[model samples]
Target: MNRKRTALSAAAAGTTAGVVGLVLIAAPAGADTTPPALPETTAESLVASVLTTDVPALSGTVAVSSDLGLPIPGLPTGDEAARIYTDGEGKARVSLIEGDGEKTLVADGATTWLWSSADKSVVKYTGGARDKAGEEQRLTDPAAAAREFVTAMGDESTLSVDGTARVADRPVYQLVVTPKPSERTLLREVRISVDSETRVPLRLEVLANGSAAPALSLGFTEFTPGAQDASLFTFTPPAGAKVTDGNAEVGKHEPTEQQKQDLLNAIKPKVVGSGWDTVYVGTVPADLLESEVTTEDKGGREGGKTTGLDLVKQFGQPVSGAFGTGTVITTKVGTALVTDDGQVAVGAVPQQVLVDALGQK
Candidate 1:
């Protein structure tokens, strides 16, 4: 649990490429066929405007599409769509639509409810847990995602206003972000569509090197900027559904100081290099290294069974270097190296970059 907390914090800070990919997944404006006409504006002004603009009460449908090209067994891919409602006053609701059921998360200023329709279960959060849930909810918001990139942009990047386009039927200004010549990354550029009137980002498109289309795209398919129903922010568990207090077990089984240190030493999360080439280095927990992830049969369909070692043998290629022998899993936007000794190095860079990162002391 401590490792999970540490890893999540690291990812939230943008220190790991894998988490960056996930955060980016949390929401893009896709390319529109016809370009819109917009008045002359500087990237500086646009950035400032997006940062300062107050988000008004709104509701929309968010569509996430990814083509990472890593078809790991049991991993969900392609399109994931959700509906979002916000009162623009710290109260919000997000419903993630799955195969046949829905998972809804609602935060009503002071409390948060996470309900799963498929399992008929709900988790209620209060106090600090409620606040944490609200923060995680914003990660899936396109405007928040856009602001993340804009704020994360550093001297290593070059930004400019490319053109104007219409996203979700609203005219928007397109801002393009590209890495400097010295940065080594598989990503080519990031494109964001900012609403012309609200200055809020409507869509984000991330294209990889050598690819014409965006490897990942997230945006609102339907957006309405106005006050949302107050009822949407409140939730009541259905009859017969099981409810659990999310904060009830906070100190029920606290780990000793030595145990915490031991777990931290075992994982040993480390970052090598900087910028887009940065790699996240860690060790595979012994339990996971020895175990496998097998899908369970659900809805009468036969579950596909596979092991961790099986995946490495099936999808990874053998690589050996100064860092030692391991298998490297390559995707359209990133690469992961898994050493035979249970070490791992992952980054949005070439395989050699991962190898060099692992070789670093």
Candidate 2:
């Protein structure tokens, strides 16, 4: 999807991680059920596939849809689609579908390049490094999303194979992963749809605890398996495009421990309750709107950025919580509360739940 690039949005949705425990619950668009349903595998095998599956080279269109009940500016909210190609090695490309122009990522195993069509800017990273934006530098596929979902879990998370269905026109096994009793995450369950033939996760969705809707969803709207053209992995910056050395320019200087603490204290909200009813208590930057999220202060591009905060101001509506009055942003997935005093609480439940969670504090 057009992922929100700001830290507050990340804190609002990310920080928790999934496949961020997928919440969307929808029968596959063209779901199919046939005999020999998945050869009876266990959660252990599915988890194994997430870690060990050797995804084959392929090319297709991926569509990520969101209803975060929040306003995300610059970044598309409803659907962020892209055409991707991978070599099954370390080479890949994603040509984003944007109206202004195309945004592409190409990795040739040695150095990766990001060319933004809208900006006509190219950022290059050598020795296989990440961008200043702190996004994955290497070729990351949809299966990696499933892997992240599984990898984020501890041994306590419960796992099960719900049944069989068709995703992206292929027969697949639906695996349900639930957080353990002790895990304090707000997520209730994550569903991953794995290709029965290849064990590749074609779709993923996360839901908040006791919630009926998916907080997030990522899936391929189109599919084409097998090797793609070799040229797709190649990259050459357009003549005269502003190219920055992504890795070198990123960490111009390191931060002191106190600066690190300041950042932590800035966004790190305490968890007041656990499971689906869980609430987070923290302080959003009083300067969320006024400050600059430079790379130096936040370290990660996601942090210290003001674009996302502006979106929050643009889209977030006012609401009162137990912590007192503030703003609330409602998405198809969950709710976020930022009080007048800068106290922040967010969860998948209703505003009242956050109020109750604040009361516990």
Specify the highest-lDDT model's number.
Answer: 1
**Tens digits of lDDT, candidate 1, 21-89:** 776776454434678778989988998999899888989888888888886544336888889989888
lDDT of 1 at 158: 88
After TM-score superposition, the amount by which residue 350's alpha carbon in candidate 1 deviates from its true location, in angstroms, is: 0.7
Compared to the true structure, candidate 1 yields what TM-score? 0.82
Q: How accurate locally is residue 20 in candidate 2, as Cα lDDT from 0 to 100?
A: 40
Q: Candidate 2 residues 1-361, lDDT tens each?
A: 4454575778766656644455323554553446235578887887787677787788877777765555454334777788878888868788886777988888877878889988889988787354433264222356877887577563657889888777778777888988776655556788898888777788888776555877677877776779888999889898979998887766565577899899788977688755454567787776764566443222334434454355455467877645677777766556777776667778756777777766765
Error of 2 at 348 (Å): 2.7
TM-score for each candidate, following the candidate numbering: 0.82, 0.72
